[model samples]
Target: MGRWVCRLGPALLLALTAVLAIRPDWNEQLFLLGHQSARLLPAVFWRLVSVFGDWKTVIALLFPLAWQQPQRLPALLAGTALAILLALLLKGGFAVPRPPLVLPVGTVQLLDALPGNGSFPSGHAMASALLATAWSAHPKVGRWGAGSLAMVAGLVALSRLAIGVHWPLDVLAGALVGWGVMRLALRHAAPQGWPEEVAQRLLALLSAVLLLAVVFTAVKDWPRHHEEYWLRLVIGTGVALGGLLRFRR
Candidate 1:
């Protein structure tokens, strides 16, 4: 079971990437499946479920994992950064319209306000899957943790479909980018020669600061629609401050 679980993440991600690359049109089929299935889903449930993939939620989830294992922080941060960067580049280069913009008017019911950007390769899916892969990096996280994280990432990907925001291919491709980046990070960027306890303490302090930034950003009168801004601030500020403190310790 453990062995299979270890292989599953890479296998699943690779499969999704390959299939999407081979048949991009298949996205419509999956989109329809989610679109029709979500018709009866409660508004409140979908809204709450969708939050699992939000940047704030991603930070909330990743921080704890990094705090517990500081050596894992580098991989986690690298995976997340790489996934998001790739997703952003793809979204811009593709300039694919979201369902609300492309679908016939009134065809799909949207649970949230429409975003004003290109939609291919959902950022929500990318971030959630990246964090999921990061968590899977540790053997101690175990099968149960991996399974739970997979479920969460699955739900987050599906939520974009459920809310009629992203096409199925966008979510699938985003997940591929996320998992692939994480795998790369684990392979080449794993922290070396760091004592676990010391790493944990340093990482924990840095995570606490990110949490505070999240809180401050949320309550402030900033443009909530500019989600990327908040994400950049959290990651950028955290890194800038963490670098200074981490080197000193």
Candidate 2:
């Protein structure tokens, strides 16, 4: 996986870079096309898709999986940390402007509030891809399952563009870096940091924290993000409780 990802990286990066540089407005035109096309899907659909990009949603899905395969945590966590560090460093280095800042007002189809800058590569896109890749390694998943996860990762990355926050270049780069980093991490996964039992306890504690955060967010945002309100309340509680119950057993 690592070798394949590394081999694919340069070619993919070069192609995307060439496309972006072919014309001054090429990136902008692509962004506009993606943003406009998003209107074909219901706003609620886009919003729901974007929800998967949120950390809580990802965690809610991963914690139980990680519990079942504690050894996988080292690679998953390492990949997450590495990808985040790279994304943050690049964001600071490039300091690219977000679509909202560059595009005219009312151009972005916003699902929620957005930040003003540091948009070289999207953190959300990277995170979703990395997590989805880790998820595909579960023992029961088949080839089709892996493909579905890949599509989910792509959609998560694309949602950043559909909602008009990130440029197409940003999404493309993020998704690639995400999958690449996960592949590298999985191939070189460090020895498990904790005993399986200990890891379960720690994961449960972390899930408890995530549950609290979900509740806070649901309350803080109220009717404005009602879907998330119910989602957080339900999934957050369920995942956290599942982890806790598993720990108890």
Candidate 3:
């Protein structure tokens, strides 16, 4: 299973990257969907999905599950951490402007700032893929769980394009990075018992609730200011640290 993941993951990434890079029409279609009329139903759905699509939210949900299988936690964390770090680095290096900031389009119902940073790889997409891949290894969840997560990851990748924040190719690259990271994590870790599993699930639920709270607050005050960013950072960091502490035990 591990070997298959290693072999197939890269191939999938490369294929996705190629499609995104070459297909301008696909991007145009995605952009068209962002129009007010087109976005009527989808906008609402994606926004709702975004709650789970967000990396922090998913992490909060998934981490506790990973914890029950302590052996799996490191790989999961490492994959997710690497994806975040890589996205940050790429954002700094590429500094691609988001659609609302650069593209001449109709009113985009932006959920958050099209951050003035790299748009090469959608971090949310990558993180989702990584989680899906890592979770694939568990006996309890197996392929079905992994596939469900991957499907969600794909939706997130599309959401980025639909909102015109990222090029289709960016989401593709993210998927690759995410899948690769998951494969690496799984190779090194595996889950353990029911108590730990329950703990992980509870933690995920709490994290999701907290994330939704923050997002709801932030959205209510759109065009988030520096203060909001700081608050989110602080709260998110605190949550992560708390989880780490719990994991250590």
lDDT of each: 0.72, 0.76, 0.63
Q: Which of the two candidates, 1 or 2, achieves a greater lDDT against the reference?
A: 2
Global lDDT for candidate 3? 0.63
Sum up the clashes in candidate 3: 7
77-189 per-residue lDDT for model 3 (tens digits):
66777778888888788776666765565556665456567777788678767766666666777555555666777777776765557766677787888777777666754
Say which prediction, candidate 2 or candidate 3, comes out ahead on lDDT.
2
**What local lDDT score does residue 231 receive in model 3, on the 0 to 100 scale?**
41
Task: Give TM per candidate.
Answer: 0.78, 0.85, 0.67
For model 3, state the Cα shift of residue 125 in Å: 0.6
Candidate order by decreasing TM-score: 2, 1, 3
Candidate 1 lDDT over 55-143, as tens digits, reads: 65676667656655677777776777777678778888999989777667887888777788888888888888877777877778787
Q: Which regions of candidate 2 deviate over 4 angstroms? A: 1-14, 21-24, 191-193
Checking candidate 2 for backbone clashes, the offending pairs are: none
Model 1 weakest lDDT span, ten residues long: 221-230
